[model samples]
Every structure is written in structure tokens, then in C-alpha cells.
Target: MEPLLLGAVIVAAGGFAFLNGFHDVSNSVAAAVRTRALAPTVAVLLAALFALLGALLGTSLAVFFVGAARGLPPGTNGLAILLTAVVAASGWNVLTWYRGTPSSSTHALLGGIVGAGIASRLTSGPAMEGAPEGFLLRLILPLLLAPVIAYLLAYLAVFPATWLLRHASPARVNRGNRMAQAVLTGVFALGQGLQDGQRTTAVILLALIGTGSADGVGIPMWVQVFAALLLAAGSLFGGWRITHTLGHRLVHIDPMRGSTAQGVGSAMLLVSGIVLHLPLSGTQVMASAIVGAGANQPFASVRRPRVVRVLLVWLGTVPATALLGAVLFLALSPLLQS
Candidate 1:
């Protein structure tokens, strides 16, 4: 019965991870599609393929960081926490996607984990010491900073590109930028796979440790391959509504601006993945990059109100997921304990 229950929970978590990949697909490919660098179908395919490859090749640093750096005691209810986090994050992702808003799956997961941890503490009595300061400093801080840095870098990259190319013919600019956007789109997809894929990997590892399958030291080959495939399939399906919102409503992105945003966002994710072992949000980073790129243009060209609406969604994701996780955990605790 315990094994069955664990299996069920892990499968559900995997499903949630796939949904996360589906919803956030736009963050990586929207710019390319919108800039006419790639057709929608091709963009989705490329994003899915590259994301899968990135997941397969990249190290599972984020999972290790989550488990060991969090300082959770052995025998803690990690399975419950993993289940709650996945449910909360997935629920939020679907909701925001439906609303055509790009919310951070990263933030949702963070909220879910913290909510479950708090609830577990209340129920089980002060168990784990919570995530370490270094984890927060190294991981959480980067998650927070990446979007802002992406924004700044994007602004800088776009402004100069636009200025230098102003003397060029419109047709030439368009052609050059279109090709550049294609390359940037691939980089963005690679970064997305590195960052977002790691988050899913971390959650799966948490589930494995919670269920007592593996010692969180390393993820099994089967688990890794399965996760990569699931996420890639989800990315292939893509999120058209959010893609439209990001591609059209957020800002008018030319090839240069799109490239700048993609490059900046990719840099942030790569740094986090390789250096800090943090799992950042591709959606948040790209959105901010888009906004930053737009800010470089004339005020009239930037859609401030629409961007503000997206920001509002971002602010709400954490609290909303936390509340949902708490409620769900509270309702389930009795049955789980029994």
C-alpha cells in the first residue's frame, strides 16, 4: 500500500511537471515566433527538442541543492511536501495560463514548498531547520535577481543594436534581426531546459527521497530520461494563449530586441544552473527581458498597462499557491497520517 501510494504521488508529480513545461513553453519560443524568425510549429519543435537535450545533458545540480542545502532532517515527510508542492505549482500554472498571464512556476514551487514545510512543522513539531542561508543567498537570491538582471541586460543590448542599425535600410534590419532571433530563440530554449528542467528534476528527487527510493545523492537514469521526455513533450504542445500575450501584447519586439531579451535571459539561467545550482524561472526572466527591451523603445511603443497586468499576476502567484497548498495539505493530513 505504501509503495502504491508513493507511485501514485510520483506519477501525479510527473504530470504536474509536464504541465509546467507546457505552460512555460512560450517564454522560450514566443519571441522567435513573434519576430517572424520561426514559424509557430517550427518554434515549438525546436524549443521542445533543445529543451529535451538540455535536460538530458545538464547536471542535476538544482536537486542536490534543494535536498542538501535545505537542511531538512532525515525521515521528514518529504513525500508529502513534494506532492503538495507539485500540486500547488501545477494548479497555479494552469490558472495563470488560462488567464493569459505568464506567472513563474519557480515562485509557485517555492511557495508550495515553504507552505508545506510550515504546515509540516505545525503538525509534526519543528522538524527540519528550513532551507539554509547559503541556499537562500545562493539560490533564492539568484532567482530574484535574474529577472532584473535580464531586464537590464536586455535594455542595454537592444538600445545599442537599434541605435547602430538606425542608419541601415528597414529590409536589411529585418533580415538580419530575423536570423539573429532564430539563434537567440534556441539559446532561450536551452536556458529554459537548464533552469526549468532542473526544477522538475529537483521535485522528482524530493519525491524519490521522500518515498525512500534513492538517497538523493543521484537521480537514476530512468528517472532522468523520463523527466526529460515528459517535459519535452509538454513543450511541444506549447501554450498558444500565453504565447500570444507575450508575443503581441507585451511589446513590439523586432529581431534585435528579441535577441537581446533571449540572450540576457539565457545568460542568467546558465549562470544559475552552472554556478549557483539554482532553479530560476524562464518565464519571469524572459518577460522581464521583453519589458526591458520595450523600455528602450519610444514610450508609445511599450504597452505599460499590459506589462503591469503581467506583473500583477507574478505578484499573486506565490501567495495564491501557498494558500492552495496549505488548504490541500490540511485536508489531506488526516488521511495521510491514518
Candidate 2:
């Protein structure tokens, strides 16, 4: 690849990472803002700091999991696939955010990648061994399962915690739970940094390898730190649209319920990061947890229809973004080559 071409690809990938940060920071700050644990600006600032820290610390595993082992090969096709994926995902995120819908940024990216991968395979033939299955099992499966698992855990956990705290004075319980909420929010931020930040790192590394700037074996420390910082800075800007959607509109939340939801969501994310080696969506996990927590409240307190609409969007994210990515890649293929 020409130096200019490589530079263009790198800059494009960095832009994608920035967009990813802009779109997904809500996952880290929404609960905190909703429960009044922090003001929106303060919450975003804190989450951004933690997210950067998490990204810098955990980018190596991400490089191995998504860049080298996944479907993308080290060349123009891979670069195109990654670029298309980010564009499609970021576009969908902006659309949903504008509508005040809290969709999963992780799923959007995953779907885009899948779509781009399949399109690339169809057009170029398979360039590497076991690419398809690797993507399906490693990337797609976790994207599907993380929310379900989070929902169940949150439902079960909140009910018990509610029961245990039921007899306490409302004011006292609220204060204690507020403190707990802060801790849980921090955990969620950490998980977001570790998992979501890594997805950007992996994609950027894929671009680097494709351009022959680095082997796929390991990401450079500078790349890891820089990517982390970019994402963190993006998070600092925060997505107020999504913050309103997930934090307030999805369901009404008290401190206890918010804590329970954040705690379970964080746990689910960390588990996925460690065991599955996949980037799971903190937004989806937190949403599921919120829904589950709401269900445990009184029947009248929960908003069934609203929850249903969000779920519908969640289900559609993968296929919708996948189709969009495929189409975009197809349209841009000639231009990319030129």
C-alpha cells in the first residue's frame, strides 16, 4: 500500500474509534445520571476517565481476539470491511440517538463487521482459514447472549436485594443505595473501557496489519494507549440523547434498582470480556438489567410497551446494520480500489 493510502486508512480508523466513543459513552454514564449519583457532565467526565484507563490496560487481549483470529484478513479487503463496519455502526447509532432510542452500539458494530465480512467473502473468496465460523462463534454468539444473561441475572438479583432492603427506612436505604450505585457505575465504566474500547483497538489493529505497518501478533503499547485516550476523550463529550433515553425514558429507576442493574450489567460484561474474549455491548446489558429491574417492581410502575419497542430495536440492530454495511461496502468497493 502507498504511504498516503495507509495514512488515510489509519485516520479513518481513528475517526471510527472516536465515533464509537461518542456513541457508546452513554452506557457508562446513563445510570449514574438517572439516579442522580452524578450530574450529567460530571458523570460523563468520570466515565471517560475510567474508560481510558480500562482501554489502556486491556487492549492486548482485544488485538488477539478480534484482529488476528476473526474473519478480517490483513489487506485492503480487511481495511474496507472495518471502515464499512464503523461507518454503518456509527450511522445507526446517530439515527437511534436522534430518536432517543437506546440501541446497542456494540451490536451495530458487530453486525456491520459481519455484513462486511460476508460481502468480502462473496466478492474476494476466503483469504484465510476458518474465518466464518470464528466470527459466528466468537463475535456474533456473545453479542446475542450477553443481554439475555444480563436480563436474567438482574431480574433475580434485584428482587432479592429489594426484599432485603424493604424494611429499612426509605431515606436511609436511598442513601446507602446511592453509594452503592456509585460503585456499580464505576464497575460499569471499567467494563465498558475493557470491552468496548478493545473493539476499536482490534479494528484499528486490523487496519494496521492490513497496511503492513504491524504484524497481527501484538498491538503496540502506543497504539493501545492512544486508542484508549481517544475513546475516553470521546466519552467525555457524552451522548446526551442516549443518556436521556436509557437513563430516563427506558424505565423509571430508584437507586436500589439502578444499582442492581448496573452491578449485574457490569458483572456480565466483565465475564464476557474474560471468558468469551468478545466485545459485548454495555448498552444492551445495562438496558436488559434495567428492564429486568423494572419488572421486579410493581406491575403499574413498569412500562411494558416502551420496553417492547426498545427490545424490538435491539433485535433489529444486528440484521439492520449488517444489511446496511453490506450495501455500503458494495457501493464503495470500486471507489475504495480506485
Candidate 3:
């Protein structure tokens, strides 16, 4: 990788991290605001704090994602591969944000990796590589199962919660849920940082090793810190559109449903990304959890049209990003070669 190309790739990765912060804010803290449990400013601030913490606390996800990058053909241009992936992922993220859709940053990156990897194989003769079968299976299967797990987990949590609080007065239930919302929102925010922040770290790491700045596979502490800080800074603004969609448009979020939905989504991210080692999307999980939470409400129909639209966006993220990545790589092939 050329120095100029490497530096350009790093700038693109940083932009992606910045977008990730803002793009995922609603996913982390919308429930708190929606339930009136936390002010929007407080919610975002807390989200920022915990996101930075989560990014600093874990390196496993970063390691795993870097390994995924390694799965691309061995002799392919690493700078080109990373640039293509970053460009596609960021482009998709911006489009989705403008449309007020909470699409998956993780999926966008993965799709870009897959697409660019394919493109490399086509253009680089035998040196560029394909993804390892084990890696692909691990990546794709968990991604497929994530929404279902989120829905079921959220439904199970909310249904039983409502039933448990049935004997309480409405006011008492609301108060309790509000308290829960405060705690869960922070937890979800932390997990978002842990899970999503590491992704940006992976890209940066790829750029470093590919461009010959780093000596080995080990990620520097500064990289983790930089990724964390960038993510938190990103969270400081520009998430209101998705916030509205999740907090108000998906369903009428009461205190209990808001807390429960966030809790379920947070737990799903912890289990899938941290425990099971799957880099699933916080946005998709939260969206599915919101629907599940709505279903548990007394006679709510779950807003089928909104649900359908969100689902469509989730389903389209990978393919759309993959196609975009492929085109980008092809378009820039000459520059990449130079």
C-alpha cells in the first residue's frame, strides 16, 4: 500500500467512525428519551461516555474483524481493499441516515469486505484471496439469526415483565420502568461502543499493517483510544432522525416498553458480539426488539408498514453495500494499481 493511499484510507476510516458514532446514538439511548426517563442531552452524553468506555474495555472484536480482513486474497492490494470497503460502508451509512433508516454499520463493512474481496480476485489474478469458508459461515449465519434472536428475546422479556407488573398500579409500573430505562440505556450505550467501536479499530489496524506502519497483528492502545474517542465525538450530534423513527414512529413507546426494548437489544448485542463473537448490528437488533416490545403491548399491531420498511432496509444493507463496494473497486482499479 502506498503512503498516500494508506493515509487516504485512514481518513476514510476515521470518517466512518465519526458517522458510526452519530448513526448509532439512537440505537443506544433512544429508549431512555422515548420513555422520558432521560433528557436527550443527558442520554447522548451518557451514551458518549459509555461508548468510549466500551471501546477501551475490549479488543477481541477488533481482533476478530482484523482477522476477517486477512481473509481476503493474500496478495491483493490491502490499501485498495480497505479504501473500497470504507468508501462503500460510509456511502451506505450516509444514504441510510439521510433516509432516516437505522441500517447496520457492521453489515456495511462486511458487505464491502466481501465485495472488494471478490473484485480483487477478479482483477489481481491469483494473488488476491477469497474469504475463508469458516469465517464466512460464522459471519453470515449469526447475522442472519440476530434479528430473530432480538425479537424473541425482547418479546419474552416484555411479555413476562408486563405480566409481572399486572397487579401494580399504572403509575407504579411507569415509575419502575423509568428507573430501569436509565440503567439499561447506559448499558446499551456501553455495549454499542464495545461492539461497534472495535469495527472502526479493525479498519484502522488494517490500514496500519497494510501500509507498513505497524510491525505485527497487535493493535496499539492508542488505536483503541482513538477509535473510542472518535466514536464518542460522533455521538455528540446528528442522530435525531433515527431517534424519532425508533422512539415515536415505530410504536407509541411507554416507559416499560422503552426500557424493555432497549434491555433486550442490549442483551442481544452482549451475547452475540461479546459472548458468541458475532459482529451483529445494534440498529437491526433494536429495530426488531422495538417490534417485539410493541407486540407485547395490549392490542398494538406493531405498525406493520414501519416494520416492513425497517425490515426491508435491514435486508438490503449487505447487498447494497456489496454492490457499491464492487463498483467502487472496479472504478478505482487504475488508481489502485498505481
Candidate 4:
């Protein structure tokens, strides 16, 4: 029973990573594709390659999820919490993907765990008490801050990028920016992999730890490879609906602004994942950068209505997924606990 539950948790984690790949690939490639810097095919392939590299290379941000896993009640309860969290997050990802909304998989994942934790504690008593505030401070706060920072950085960077090319011919400027955007898109994807790939890997690790199959000392190579490959595979599938929203509906950006936004988004993701040991939403950061870069244009070009809808979804994702996670836990707990 324990082995089966553990297997379910790992499978759910992989599914979430795949969903994450399609859901968030827009963040990495939308700007480049929209600017005609890279064909959609080339952009996706590049993203897949780098995303795999990024995931396989780093596990710095796994600490938070691992800590969360350790906090859950041992045995079936812990496995169920992990399973339901991944399941709930994956459900939200599918819904958002179907609706063409670019929501945060990071928040959804965190919310799932938190929701399941809270539900477990409430129903099963103090044995499952979990630190929701710790999740807030360590993971959520950084994720929330990353997008705002991305927007500001993108907003400021665009001026200099535009001014530098101000005197250049439009043809020459577009060509150069396209090339730069292509490179930066891959970089952005790499950072994204680093940020998101560790998330599923962490969940899998937590399940292993819970079942005593492994200690929580370090990420297993097989786990990293599995998560990375699934994430890369999902990237290959690409989420064109959300891609349309990101590249077309959310903002109107030229080659220069698109390049600038990609650059800022990539830098933020890399820094947060590698240096700060933080888990952030590549979707949020990239989308915020796009809007910021577009803000310099006519106000109408920013697509206020679409932006508002996106923002509302962003604000609701964590809480909504939390509720979903709790409900899913209630629904699945009987089977898991039996």
C-alpha cells in the first residue's frame, strides 16, 4: 500500500511537471516567437533543451518543498498530502490551460501542499500541524516579489535598449533584436527550468523521504532526470492557447521591447533560482515584464482588460488551488488512508 501510494505521488509529480511545461513555455518563447525572432518550432526546441539543462543542474530551491513534505504526518497521510497537492495543482493547470489563461504553477503547487496540510491538521489533529506561514515567507513572498521586480526592471531597461538603437535603421534594429531575443528566450527557458523543474523533483523527494526509500540529504539523479525529461517533453507540446494570450492579447511589443522583456525575465529567474534559493513563477515574471515593456507604448496598447483578467486570475490562483487541494484531500483521503 505504501509503495503504491509513493508511486502515485511520483506520477502525479511528473504530470504536474508536464502540465507546467506546456502551461509556462509561453513565458520563455512567446516574446521571441511574437517578434519573429524564432519560429515557434525552433523556439520550443531550444526551450526544451535548455529547460532540461536547467532542471538537471540545480536543486537549490528544493529545500522549501522538502521541508513541507517533512512537516506532513508520516505514512499514508504524508503520501496523501503530497499526492493531493500535485493532483490539485495539475487540475488547476489544466483548467487554466484550457481557458488560455497563463497562471502560476508555482503558486498552485504551493497552495496544494498548504491546503492539504491545513486540511490534514484540521481533520487529523496536531500530529499534522504544518507551517503555512513558513511557506508564505519563504516561497510565496519571493514569488510575489519576483513579478513586481520583473516589471520594474523591464520598465527601466526598455528605455536604455530603445535609446541605444534609436538611430539605427528599423530593418537593422529588428534583425539584431530578433537575434538577441532568440538567445534570450533560451536563457529564459533555462531559468524557468531551474525554477520549476526543482519543484516536481522536490515533491518526488518528499514522497521518497516519507516512505523511507531515501533520506532528504540531496536530490537523487534519477529524480532530477525524470522531472527534467517530463518537463522538457511538455515544453515540446507547447500551450498555443496561452501562447496566443501572452504573445498577442496581453501586450503589443516590437522586437526591441520583446527582447528587453525576455532579458529581464531571464535574469530574474536565474538570480532567484540560483542565488537567492527562491522558487518563483516564470509565467508571472515574464508576463509582468511583457506588460511593463508594453506600458511605454500608448496606454491602449497595453490591453487593460486582458491584463486585468490575468491579474485577477493570478491573485486568485493560490487561494483557489488551496480550496481545491483541501477538497481533493477530503475526496482522496479515505482511499489513501484505508
The TM-score leader among the candidates is 4
lDDT of 2 by residue, 1-338 (tens): 44554565556656666766787788877877788877777777778878887787665457545543455665667777777888888889888878777788778877887888777776764443455665557766777887888888888998689789879999988888888777776778888888867776776677777777877777777777767888887787877887787777767888888888888888887776776566688888888888777667665566778778888999899899999989878876776567
lDDT winner: 4
For model 1, the stretches where C-alpha displacement exceeds 4 angstroms are 68-76
TM-score for predicted model 4 compared with the true structure = 0.96
Displacement of the residue 81 alpha carbon in candidate 3, Å: 1.3
Residue-level lDDT tens digits of model 1 in 1-338 = 45655675668667876887799899888888988889999899988988887777676565655554355433336566667767888888888889889888889987887777777777873455756666677666766777788888888887678789989998898888888778777777877787776666776666666657778667777777777888888998998999999899988877778878887888887777777567778888999998888778765667889988988887887788888877776766676677
Q: After the best TM-score superposition of candidate 2, give how far the Cα of residue 108 lies from its true spot, in angstroms.
A: 1.8
Pairs that collide, model 2: none
Taking all chains together, the TM-score of candidate 3 against the true structure is 0.94
Report per-prediction Cα RMSD to one decimal: 2.0, 2.4, 1.8, 1.6
Off by over 4 Å in 3: 73-76, 125-128
CA lDDT of each prediction against the hidden true structure = 0.77, 0.76, 0.82, 0.88
**Cα shift from native, residue 185, model 2 (Å):** 1.6
Tens-digit per-residue lDDT, 1-338, candidate 4: 88888999998999999999988898898999898999999999999999999998777787766774566676888888889889999999999999999999988987888888888776763346546776648866888888799889998998898889889999999999999998998899999999889999998888888888888887889999999999999999999999889999988999999998999999888888888787888999999999899887645688889999999999999898899889988887677656
